[model samples]
Target: MIKTIGFGIGLVRFANAACTSGDGLEGVCRTRRECARIGGTGSGRCVNGIAVCCVVQKYCGDVTTSNSTYFANPNFPNLYNGGTICTFTIRKLSDDICQARIDFIAFTLAQPDANGLCATDGLTITGGASTVPTICGDNAGQHIYVDFNGNSTIQLNIFTGIAANSRVWNFKVSQIGCDCPTRAPSGCLMYYTTLMGTVRSFNYGTTGNAAMTRQLANQNYGVCIAMQPGYCSINWAQTAGDLYSFTVTGDSPTAVTTGTAGTNAVIGALCTTDFVVIPNPTFTGATPGAANVDRFCGNAFQPLTTNSKPFVLTVVNDANEVGDIGNRGFSLDFTQQRCNNVPVIG
Candidate 1:
């Protein structure tokens, strides 16, 4: 799925030749003087090692159309205390570009309300194919894939209303060409490419105060994992000692289970509202009917192995939180296993 590359904002100003920076960020080929004029940092070389690889970065109130651009809150690296809205607009570098990938290198904002709503502070995306939930709290290292679907521009707005907490955010926005191999499949809000990685719910991090409810409500999206070649199965395990992980509550008297056998394993219809769908879950050392458990909720996730092709994990959360359940959400570790290939002899 290779697509022709396109240049980003002010394509006429920067050289058309693509290059990479020393820190491995994507950039455009520009002379040192041109790079300096645009406030880009120059590293590495392009155009037969003669032109500089100029990495462009934008801040709040800036509009960018460049590929592989970095945008951050004003006075980034330092906390932003202003209680206001900061926005960055992204225009397609070219018509061939069909998606935007936003990586949150560092994100911290005022916490959501008790009901898991981003009422106080949040990050919102406007004009993309997918509905990105308004997110707040600590989401550093999280990333999102947005589909352009012919929209000419996209906007990222960070809203800070309360003044107490110091806010900071740094993000890298990369435009994805249509049919790009790295582009996420349509409808996957979050995508993973590595053979092994951790998938945490948005704002899945430490809560400084007890009043905060870590789980965000009304979240329903697919978290897709790119199936690495030669790998046929993926194993999911709960992060050890992370108590808040997998705290999606169920109806009372159903009682959350710890992956134990018998009626203890909550699966399928047993998980009514909030549950993670792990298709065709296979429990290691399982008892009767234990392997049948697919949808999991009620506070714990056991080690699960599955051979589901295309590797998609669906997270479904309803609108409201159960009373005093303290639903903190999930943190899961996944590793794809290689398939065994046997030699055929004549």
Candidate 2:
């Protein structure tokens, strides 16, 4: 019995009295009757105790127009048994909103197949300018940025298999206005704005036999980092200790090493299947014989620094994962360096 829930956006008025709930979530101040009509719960008192602070939550089959809405599974945090389809649509809070960010607070579905395809279970997002890959598995801490310029509504469709595996998913969607300075670029799947932060592949953090086929297939998108004021260069270093830290290619997780700590550029043949692109890369202290040292792929990562403005990293994956069985994905740390004016390319 597959229950189909269609989620879409509609025109809804904003709450006149915005307030914060007891658990630190944003809510609107409303009367008890108004709150219950929209299936919201009264978390606390608001409007100087004259109204209830209502925390609005949308479940399967519900369409929400409110900003910062929590779109979750029915009885979220609890696993929903297989054989169900949940869909939801989110409309722009206003016409000026340009982007929406979906943060996976708690997402767990059936793992992808051997070919890195979401055959059994998957979640697909539509109505965005950028193409997003269908994803499954434990992606609790990941987030996606969708550009919604020409369209006012975005839809989320979740399909679960008939198998006995239980699934759980909970995410929050926050709208970003066009004028917002921190908005993500047009085609970036993920965006970071801080001076230093970590960027990991989807479904990262698993290891060994259990991690085989964790990487998503048919993915081609940018992971952008906003340039901070006065920062002239950025340094990228893969997280140490995990052998599969940079394993986008190779037979086994440790079968390939493209270059020695960014000493040489990666060849084109090795990156034919999947690769991460560092555009116009520059390194300190050594000059290689190659003209371009931009693309990176393989089981090893070479630490490199670049002065590329509007810092961006592009990740591309092919349609199939035939030889990518043991690839666990990548986790990289990026730090923006302040302008020292000593010439970055020594």
Candidate 3:
């Protein structure tokens, strides 16, 4: 909550009259109210020698990005040419004092070049310069803080030298107060898995193949998950199999399935299976996008199990092949939580 208190010139005279008991001692008073009465406001009255003052109050609202700017290299399409810096100023509308946390979401769309491409290789900003505080790698966004210091405005900066055409970039700024606990930095643990099978020609478009089956374990709160087709990159043998169905089960052991076989079957007969699954993944706000991999394909469930704890994550890939030989494969990576030497508050 926010509140403002003050009085105008006329109210000062009224206050002085009440304080002086209507003795006409206005000119001898030092308070602004006294001066107003002596200045000829005859309406001044002393009601029980008490004075009234004006006060105003207002509610605090959401924080907003009040200003944003992008700075590019002066000599684009030339040596050492690219975006140099980006800055944002966020403001909160409130009469009360509050603090805010700022986070920069950056994406690159530039093509790969000898300069190792403008990959989101962690929050480097610039190569070999200085690492950004609270850096969370390239694909994922980085979190920063801006103390209002009881002031009306705050600013944040994101300096970069990445080639301008690599990926798309976006940012989100949120106001955090004492009510929320600060998040801890954790390391990522990646796991790999594989499956194999065979398919018949009839399983093509005419009738979906039920032979292929895939299942992933439920996720934990504060965690995120993603999946992608594997083994497609290599020149592995391909086949026209029946329906390609993938099922994912949550804590309740219920199954959710999607995909079609034959024409819809994953293009590669044998490809690497990739999925991003993390328990208790923290997000700055609502509708946070998947950071490292493709979007989620199965049912979205709470990251925590019924017991209110992290759940064991599992992925099952199933595929079928015809002719003399057939094979299916997959892999997974799990990120582990890491502790940093962050300062503790009393």
For model 1, how does the per-residue alpha-carbon lDDT over 224-283 read when each residue is reduced to its tens digit? 999887788899877766655566664322343334322333567778877898888787
Error of 2 at 336 (Å): 0.5
Clashing residue pairs in candidate 1 are: 8-65, 8-66, 9-65, 9-66
Residues 205-301, candidate 2: write the lDDT tens digits: 5554353777878888889998776788899877766656777776644363334543322434457878898877665435442347677886666
User: Poorest 10 consecutive residues of model 1 by lDDT?
Assistant: 252-261
Question: Which candidate wins on TM-score?
Answer: 2
Name the 10 consecutive residues with the lowest summed lDDT in model 3: 53-62
Deviation in angstroms for 298 in model 2?
0.4
Q: Which runs of model 3 end up more than 4 angstroms from their true locations?
A: 7-81, 85-170, 181-275, 278-346
Best-first order by TM-score? 2, 1, 3
TM-score of each: 0.83, 0.85, 0.26
Candidate 1 local Cα displacement, residue 159, angstroms: 1.3
In order of listing, the candidates' clash counts read: 4, 4, 60
